[model samples]
Target: MKAAVKRVPVRNPANALTVLRLVLVPVFAVLTVMSEMTDSSLRIAACVVFGVASLTDFADGWIARTWGLVTAFGKVADPIADKALTGTALVLLSWFAVLPWWVTGLVLARELGVTLIRFWVLRHGVMAASRGGKIKTMLQIAAIAWYLWPFPAGLAGVGPWLMAAAVVVTAVTGLDYVFRALALRRSTRA
Candidate 1:
């Protein structure tokens, strides 16, 4: 006789919010591109949608932890939802020349590389987010938000500067994760 595998529920509030954020990615992307139109309303709408979607990220995490509804689905999907949102925003902004490609490249490289390393070391143990990682996330989100907003000419330099800080934090945190994963893999090998 074979035992059936038990599955974790993927329909929790946290996962639902995570999925909602994912769904909003394309909507956000389209709005961002449309914001390029002559109408200022599109730009404002884009930013508002982005801001609401960003809020869900924090809400999902908080609700999951506070309500004791955390699950493996939330763990995996939440980060992917975040990456999808940030990655698309970065890429789209770069496409429109609002952001420099180099900055987008740096952030994407770090994010993608760290994500790969996370899966590679999954068998060893689960890696927890460090304080630095949290800071990196916040900086990235703030920078992206600033970029999405249609600020005036006087404040043009702010987004790039924030992105520069985000890039630095992202790189540092990525390296930290790599080292942690390697150590975990080493310790588990014995």
Candidate 2:
């Protein structure tokens, strides 16, 4: 007889970090909106809040794997929290004319598409996070942070370059995910 698998508790440090990220999303959005395209205290506060929340994304994943605290809730909520935080940042940056609307739209579309693909292939198998996905996330966070921070005028050019790289990675990884999803579905059928 096969032994039953041990279950990790949903209420753990790792999942707590994920939850914190989700909660911080709205707070970050409010701060960004309050900034109103100025290098005021509100912008700085928004930057700091966004930085903290972004760190939690890394922390929770590390803690989950290191401490074996992986749970179903974490699996579902982690990505949602990540997308929410990034999505809010992107939208706010675009709204304030900090970043272009097309950039925000493209990133949102790719993110949303990937989520849909995951659901499409859910019955066949779970799609693991790829290395490119991690890189895409890092680029997105760095780009968003660059725009959020009230940096000097001279350094203003850096954010767009970072964002451009992020866009490229995002599109590439998204296509890779779709191809992998299709392969998985086909394999399962055969």
Candidate 3:
């Protein structure tokens, strides 16, 4: 006997939100890097855009899971949107000299590498985001948020530390995922 499969449509509210987040990626980067984060108004506007995009990142996933609207597109585009938003901000921040080149490079490398691993293992099976991956995402968001917001001089030093922590989490989770993907790929071959 064959097991029955349920189909989820590609077009849905959840997917729409995911696409919206993707669209916000370039906008957020422009707002962040245009005035070089020096103009207080531009910085604030960038933060608002980043915050809204980040919120949709969570909302779309929640709505999809809760309403059974999950789809292949969501599985792919959602994560892409997330990486685009965070990666763009990190790259732009580094370009503006607000973030260190090493920090941006390390974080983006881990993000892009893990995303590649996901595609690599997709032929074997879909690997859901581990708990550590979720932690890494939240930390990245918080760290990015800290950098975006203009704070008092005394509190400004905390931003880099947060980013450092996020980078650490990103590296750890990225390694974990690579290992899992390799194992899955081997299993499929066996």
Candidate 4:
């Protein structure tokens, strides 16, 4: 007897949201680069767009679960949108001297490292986002948002602390993922 296979379609609301996020990336980047015009108005505009784009990250997942519209495209596009938005923000922030080079480098390294691990694990099977990974994502968004905003003088200091916390969480979760991947590989080997 032949095994039955199920196919998941790509046109889903969640995937649409992911595409929206991807579109926002270049818009945000353009705004950030134009910061010099109108006394940093562009940066503020970029922050607003970036924040709205970030919110879609949560919304898309929620819609996917609520409506049962999850698809492989959503799975892939969502994370790519997240990394592009956050990575672009980090690069822009570093360029503007809002964040140190080392800080951005470490954060970018963690993101890239985890993505590679995910791909490696995918060769065997799928791995969902862990609780720690979610927390790290939240922390990263908060830190980037705070850094972008130009209000509340004292709140400016919060960005660095949030970034630091994010780094710690990112490192721990990344290591956990690597270990899990290794274990999965071993079990498959066995």
Highest TM-score: give the candidate number.
2
Best by lDDT: 2
Collision pairs in model 1: none
lDDT tens per residue, model 2, 31-106: 8887796957899899889999999999999999999999989999999999999999998899888899999999
Count of backbone collisions within predicted model 1: 0
User: Each prediction's Cα lDDT score?
Assistant: 0.86, 0.94, 0.89, 0.85
Rank the candidate models, highest TM-score first. Answer: 2, 3, 1, 4
In candidate 4, how many Å is residue 124 off? 2.3
lDDT (Cα, tens digit) per residue for candidate 3, span 97-133: 8999998899888888887888788889989999999
lDDT of 1 by residue, 22-125 (tens): 99999988998877733467767877777788889989999988887888889988999999998998898888888889988988998889889988998899
Report the C-alpha displacement of residue 125, candidate 4, in angstroms.
Answer: 2.0
Error of 1 at 173 (Å): 0.7
In model 4, the clashing pairs are none
Which scores greater on TM-score, model 2 or model 3?
2
**lDDT at position 144, candidate 3:** 88
**What lDDT score is found at residue 61 in candidate 3?**
97
RMSD of each: 3.2, 1.1, 1.9, 2.3
